[model samples]
Target: MIDYIMQYQSEIWQAIGETFVMVAISIVAAILVGLPVGTVLFLCRKGQLYENRVVFGTLNIVVNVVRSFPFLLLVVFLIPFTRFVVGTALGTLAASIPLAVMAIAYYSRLVEQSLLEVPRGVIEAATSMGASTIQLITKFLYVEARSGLMLGMTTSTISFISYSTVMGIVGGGGIGDFAIRYGYQRFETELMVVTIIIMIILVQTIQYTGSLISRMLDKR
Candidate 1:
């Protein structure tokens, strides 16, 4: 294993870098796009301030459909759209299209759930104070739900890393792709074990950090 690591140190690093790139894009998509869509979903739900069954139903279906697809099939399903967006459906960058989509769907649902946990009284208090819609959400809703949101983001990011592994199917090279080519396909069992260990460590670290932060942010 050590010998293999020494021999492929550069390749391993490069693959790790590619994984970071894909995961980073997914994180950005989840934050910029997913977070807002989720906020909208929460606000537009039945009996909420912006209640609109039409809008909620449409977005709900879209989110559900995207989430329902197996990640691999989702990759295949998004080929044309990915190609159109990135000019090719192969490579680290192209893989981001589907990753972003999945991240949005997955995280939005979590975000909505997180927001649901916020105390109703907080919202009512803001309303009584004549807070505008923006003020209510930013000051009361998000402030109260920030911890849940952080934890949700942490969970989504870890899934993003896992999802990135399969992007290698479309020539999107990453640590998983390297493992496939050098470890599994090439019968380098030790190298495969090493990659698995790395992934486990990465996940454990992220989970611990997220949980710690969530606890710190929780007032109750």
Candidate 2:
């Protein structure tokens, strides 16, 4: 283990950094884009504020279509768009474009579900207090559903990390790329084990932290 660490220490560290970069950017983008999209989805559903079948149906179809595509296919399908956005689709930055896109679609559904978990009674109470649509969502729905929202984001982040690994197949550099190049291709079992360990550690850390935060924020 020490020998492997010493031998590929620099490469391993670099791969770790690249993985963080990809996951961090993608997850942040996912939260920013998904939050509003999901909120809109919730509001437009049957009997909710701003409800409209045409609008809800249209957005629903788009989200489902994007989400249903396999990650690998999405990666390939978005190559042209990724190139146009990032000027190249073979590096960390380029890879992040697809990661963010997929994350947005996946996380939006999670966010929508989280928002739906908000109690209808709370919404009614807020409405009785003369809460505007915006106020009801911002104050009642968001506050009440924060715990679920956090959990959803947590789950999405973990999924993003796993998806980021697949980017390695497309030349997007990360620990996954490192594993493939050294561990799989070059038959370096120790290096592969190390990478796997690191990934497990990362996922566990995120899961624990997210759960803790969610628990703390959950008032009911």
The best candidate by lDDT is 1
Q: Please write out the lDDT profile of model 2 over residues 1-220, one tens digit for every residue.
A: 8899899999999988999999999888887898888899999999896898998898889899989999999999999999999788788898998899888889889989998888788978998999998898889999999999999899999998999888886677888889999899999899899999999999999999999999999998
Mind giving the per-residue lDDT tens digits that candidate 1 earns over 198-218? 899988999999999999988
The global Cα lDDT (0 to 1) of model 2 is 0.90
Give stretches of model 2 more than 4 Å off: none
Worst 10 residues of 2 by lDDT: 166-175
Candidate 1 TM-score over all chains jointly:
0.97
TM-score of each: 0.97, 0.97
Candidate 2's displacement at residue 36, Å, is 0.5
